[model samples]
Target: RLPVRVDVPVEELTRDDGLFLVGTPRGVLRARNVVLASGSLNCPKRPPASADLPATLRQLDSSAYRNAAELEQGAVLVVGSGQSGGQIAADLALAGRPVFLATSRAGRLVRHYRGSDIFNWMTLSGYLDVPRREIVLPSGKLPPRGLLGATHTISLQSLSAQGVVLLGRFMGIENDSLIFGDNLDEHMRFADESSADVKRFIDDYIRRARLNAPPAEDDPAEMIAPRLPSPPIHSIELATSGIRSVIWCTAFRGDFPY
Candidate 1:
């Protein structure tokens, strides 16, 4: 019945019993209850998901490739180096497949690194007066559970040690291969594990804080260090399986085209 309108982009799926949607630059469109299987904002340089395509195409979005080959015969490229990208790339590489990870920024470490997790560190130290604390995280593609990131930091460290190759910057795709703007491969070859020293020091801090529990001295910001660098995403290459899948992982504006 609604053949021609099937191709249009729906701006908003209203909350009413009748699903009301505003079309892109057109007008309002409606359905019973709209389901938003539609992916992120559109870009001209990427491909939509297609089965039998290269996993690299699914892995790296538009930032890496204009289009990817779907035969799965060539190299797989994992874009980005934040916890997700790094983890993905490491998994691919360890599988004995040729893979590459593109990163626009370098990953960082906390100033005071400890073998213990941050939550434990916080409790053992004087950062939090209560046993539990609250944290806020940026809202994104992930489903909303609460306000903050609660994952343990160990996952990132383990991935870095697993041998994921890190590349710097996207220079655009060329010559059937993904390339970088700079030579970061030689430097980021391994994770910074010596950070254990930082962690051990935190253990010492907590021990001292426990002895003074109430207030021997107020905690100073200078005493606690910050996190080390980790890479942020620019773009990705999803064209490894033969079909290029382009995804834009950048921040979005409040886009409404009604």
Candidate 2:
């Protein structure tokens, strides 16, 4: 696929009496046999755990990442790439903001070499039925999870090629300046280089877990990425400290959606 864009309003999920996993306007997307293969919640968000960092980092920015014009440039940081992060990064680049995008999980490879859309590998591989933790279990070796679904990993190379800096997950934020885990770059580069390896890792991990294989022979990724420096953080002193606006693109957790 060559990245053809689509225009469908999700609101079409609300026209029926059926139970809604999500209540979109179209109608309830009902399932007689509901299974949560990836029991993740909505996007994870930041919390007010420090002093000096603006309280702003802890809440949802009404405009999302695309309208980052209100943010100051030079050191802008974007936290996730699920659709929102990608759009935000694209908007920042178009707006010419010195942007930085970061995420812990490298995304899936689009099916076509040109990135039209991800390989329907998740649905294709039947992972939708596997327990979610198969990807995280120490003794398990599933696909690297780079193939689950469409991720925002919104163009790591594109960001760099276009001059947008990228980072790893947000450990915390420093006074106006953000503090990230130390291995941000290394972790990211590894994800970027071998998405294929990540996929293999995830595949094996799940199989092992399903078969109750012992830890002695779990097949981790053949390509071992240099582990990120245990802790990654971005620290900038508040006021004129380069990063004027911090866009937290981290994910949201799954709630009952009541």
Candidate 3:
């Protein structure tokens, strides 16, 4: 049987010969090998604009954010377009709050294409098993993850249609005004192109494999279409715009105590 320790904080780890000594709150422990699973989402990131916010305003990283009910009275500025930011912005806007979503160019995928889930299509296409060595970028960086939902795809486009103000990537805050980049059109185009590419891949895979997939339907078009245009906002005066809170969901990093 393997022994396990829980609720102990690891303070230090040192290697001697081929073994590792771990210092913990309880005591020192010895191990032949150590596997660090610190987790990717342990530390949430905040934007630079968050640093100079007034004391009166509330700020919550996406990890600390629960729901619109948890926020104080006033509008909210969600400073990312990733899954967390997209979902949270939709949630707040649906709850009748004036929500502004600062978007980055993130890929979008359909929840269900034809009669299959997008994940199933991904698996069938062998996209999930792509080797890192074969596809590694020159910069050694992976591509940004696409926004997907298990139940149903949460479309930023749909969120825009639902009264959520979509802005370009946040630049920084200048005095009382928040500045944003002028790449909103480019971001929207990228999302649309990425989604089309995915759909095309799926269609080709079905044809090549001779899979008996359902015929094309209009639902896909209706679902992917943006009902409203993304707002062309360069900057907004935070105080005058009635925004009282900011939620930064830029990225997550692993936090290793030792």
Candidate 4:
């Protein structure tokens, strides 16, 4: 049986004589071929603007947020629109707390489509298992995962319908006000296009494979689009906004030391 190490903090990793030398608190271990299974998401990433946020307002990383009952008695400002940000904002709003979401260009996905889970369609379409070498992006980087609810579809439009105020890309704090970019419409459009692209990919796969999948059903949640602010909100004075807490659901970073 192969040996496994648990609760061992790797202090350093080195290569010598075609062998990997791992230094841990206990001792050094040698192996012919080492597989680094240490994950990349070891630290929460907050925007540089986070440093300029007002001192009185409470700020918590997305990783630290548990529930609305723990927050102060005021509105919440979720400063991202990825999976965590969207879900947290939805959770707070559903719990009867006012929530303001600073949106990003992150895409959305429907949990279930065409009488099957979206993952099933993805596996059948051969898109889920595409090799890394086959991925081609303009910047030669991998694409980020889109926002998909755990058991239901979550979209910007649906969040707006639930009384959560949506704002544009957060620029920074200016003169005690939260400055935002004037691209809320563009952000929303991008989410719609992303969902449409995925649906189109699955549709093409079904047609090419001659699979007799049931017809697509209209998701009423996605159809609800609240009228966006004209010219988009460029700034909101923090003092008057009633926002007492800010959740930095921005992203995570790899904390690899080698």
Ranking by TM-score: 4, 3, 2, 1
The digit string of per-residue lDDT tens for model 3 on 16-120 reads 888899999888888898988777668886766678877777988988988899999889999887677878887898799999888887877777888988889
lDDT of each: 0.41, 0.50, 0.80, 0.87
Query: Least lDDT summed over 10 consecutive residues: which range in candidate 3?
Result: 221-230
Model 4 is weakest, by summed lDDT over 10 consecutive residues, at 136-145
TM-scores of the models, in the order given: 0.39, 0.52, 0.86, 0.87
For every model shown, the clashing-pair count is 41, 53, 0, 0
Off by over 4 Å in 2: 1-44, 48-52, 55-63, 69-75, 81-83, 111-116, 125-129, 136-153, 174-176, 198-234
Misplaced by over 4 Å in model 3 are 6-9, 16-18, 131-140, 218-231
Name the candidate, 2 or 3, with the larger lDDT value: 3
Distance from true location, Cα of 117 in model 1, Å: 2.1
Worst 10 residues of 1 by lDDT: 143-152
Distance from true location, Cα of 67 in model 3, Å? 1.6
Ranking by lDDT: 4, 3, 2, 1
Q: List the RMSD of every prediction in angstroms.
A: 12.5, 10.6, 2.8, 2.7
